[model samples]
Target: MVLRLNIDQIEPATRDWICKVQIVEIGRPRESLDKKCTFQNLILEDEQECQIRAVMYTDEIEQYVSTLKLFNTYLISTAKVKVSLTSYGKPIHRFYWILDKETVIEEIKPSDEVEKPLSPPNKLTITSFDRIPHLMVDSTAEIDVLAVVLHCGPQKTAGRSHHKCREITLCDNQQNQFLFTLWEDFGEIEGHEIYSKMATQRDLLVILGRSIGISTYQGLSLQTRYNSTVRVNPNYPQAVALLNWAKQNKTMLLSSPSDTTSTSSSITPMIVTPSGQQLLSIADISSAASMGVFCVNAEMAILDEFQDFCVLECSGCKQKKRTKDRKDFHCPKCNRKTSLVPRCSFQIDLIDNTATTTASISAELGEKLLSMTAEDIFDITCTKRQSLSLNPVHEMLSTKVFDIQLRKSSWTSSNTTTTTLSILSYMEKQHPPQSTTDRTSKKIKPLEISEVEVMPTTAAAAPSNAVGKLQPPTPTKKV
Candidate 1:
């Protein structure tokens, strides 16, 4: 008998266990130091979502990794579990399962019972922007949101990794404006196609099964995950209703103040960190300016080495300082002789599967994460080494994972829209909190909704404890 172990239940100490999981995403194969490994993000569900990351070392499990298909369920056993090694890989769970030589893998036959729940959900039960506050913090609760496409940014590679992303600004009937970020292949073509029609006519965009979360800087934004689907101008009843509502509210959305007015104001400022410290992809930093400061757990080696990773900054305003006499320093922002602090103003480029972005760490925080003072890095860079050895900064940051506290700062005026990240604090160790389901299941007051937004009289009378199940998709006439 195959022992079905949930992804969340698998820990570093667990061994010789069986896990039935669907391969949700396959990362590009990476070759490092004469060894190749591929990372796969898997999902295990038993009436609830449980996600985890698994790695296949090339020497032991290369053949199995190549034959695995995305969205296909497999029963895997004899796998090794270890504390997650890399943070920049954007691990889905706190711990990662490793497939070694002894692992056994088999594909399960698809069946009616399995197919019904496993398929991508087609019907979208729309959630209003005002109800965003009710969304459980730091948890990936499936949500459907409908809005009119206002703007779509060009798609670009995010970090040093294989992640790609695009930005979309949307508005709803209630003059609620939101920022939806598309990662990887989600809405890649649809965003561009909608961009062309945005100026010509009103276009309704439906984001189904998108992960909704609140951030510290950009407030609430829609994030696309591996299972999320995006459709433009679909011929559904909800889409038609939203289209009409958008048409009625076009004038209000246009006249509203872009800088001050935001849909996030209706929601509270509390954003729980999912996977600890709201583990965000590199691509999320650009649109997270309004969400406030958040934390990301990333591997130390994910960043590239450069000289400017360490520099001098003014202690008063935390801005870069300019020196005329090498002793006296002047800050451009303060424009006064300020005491220049030798700090690490490291511009580290971080890459993950979703996207890539550069993060600038403060000297004090950089020293803590790297375990090396700015002066130590300066000495190593300034003085030539006779033998081959890694730089002091690289030696410390190259192979470790850290939970980094990042706050959004200014951005460069370049076309790429580079966002600056100020590191507040960092720790080399991470302790996984209770599972999301356990945390979210805790008692919280229900949100009050108006009559119009409530369900129909018949459905509203259904059992209070009933969980809504997805109905099979029906054929509908194209709009």
Candidate 2:
């Protein structure tokens, strides 16, 4: 029998080495842009608990698709070991494996005759909730999370594709709260469960497996990817500790009402504005200047002339066209001719007795304020296409008192400082959120609010509308 080696000891020169490892993760089979090639990735771990990513091309993937199952131990040999070019490989080891047709794989079957092999390593990397803010700088590093579920927003449809999404507020031991989103099926299944639980249970413990951090303008947030898993109140020491912490701070966690957010692009991403949303005085907002997000009770102090009230955005990527005309007939960014969607683009002055700032409004809340969809409004403005017109929004909001959520960002240059505030959502005092929640749950209708304008999580000289991610998304997989 050949001696087995740990993942750390295997190198490019170790041609004769064999590894008795368990498959911890199995990435979906991905095809190239041209659909000319296909590949699947696997994360393998040995007895020492060291992990490394192993990839299989179309040929090898088909050969072992059934032979290699998750949690099954196998004897692997003759796979090439190469240095990883990315830091996102969940690494203490720098090398990744590539198994070709020549590589040997043998599933170690269970037997009564011999002693049982070591159990498969769970391969969980539980990241502290506080550390998530710092970890946002590395988008590719997927982290497991143990968080207390404070609130669950009603699952709603969003985006041009009308994807189903749900947002939940998660609290860590440090008392720091952040939003986590469940997309598509995860939202339908787990989101429905949590929303149902909130009716009875005050706090719920959730264990997330392999969640990606989205450092949006809303600060550090989390979302489920295609490979991510959601486990509710699993039996574990870390989760038990988190449960104890949640029980201690139930009131504080649920004090401030929020709608929550989705995507990595939005910050102050709280979309849930309580129906009875209480407005805070401008004086009250100024005192909590250190906070990244603020929901103030303010009125339309001023409304700017609606110059570009609506901009045409690429339906595929949801980015505005950069052409000089700003309304190019077709999207240049997409590989093919993609459709354009009309989104609300305007600004209004929000004011209280103590302070004031210009808050930009786009899509989401802008629709509610105007009482019209962006598309319908866009068509009306396009006939004769007036450049600047009397802003109609002022008249509607001038007399109305609304609860507005704003994200504050500042920049300093040439010894001069400028601050920008953008409105995230608005709430009518008479209209309660629970009523809206019940309607959407039965209808499952989606809302489209693609464009997000806010600064990074950290304070910097960057403009208010500019959003920064740890790394630009990879053009190919978008994984």
Best by TM-score: 2
Off by over 4 Å in 2: 1-3, 87-93, 112-115, 127-133, 138-342, 348-356, 365-479
Top-scoring candidate (lDDT): 2
Question: What's the lDDT for all of these models?
Answer: 0.48, 0.59
Worst ten in a row by lDDT for model 2: 436-445
Clash count (model 2, backbone only) = 10
Which lDDT tens digits does candidate 1 get at residues 1-479? Answer: 55567777666666657776666545434444334533333333322446655766556445775567666667778677777643232334567666666778777666645533245323444677655544524444546577766556677543223256666666666555556667655546655666666657653354333333332222345666543446576555666787777667666655543322223222111111222234665456555434345666654442334334455545554444443122556655456775754554454544344444555554344444455566665555433322213377566655555555555533222222322344444455444323211111222221112223222110101012211221211233222
Give candidate 2's error at residue 124 in angstroms.
1.4
Predictions: Cα RMSD each: 23.7, 13.0
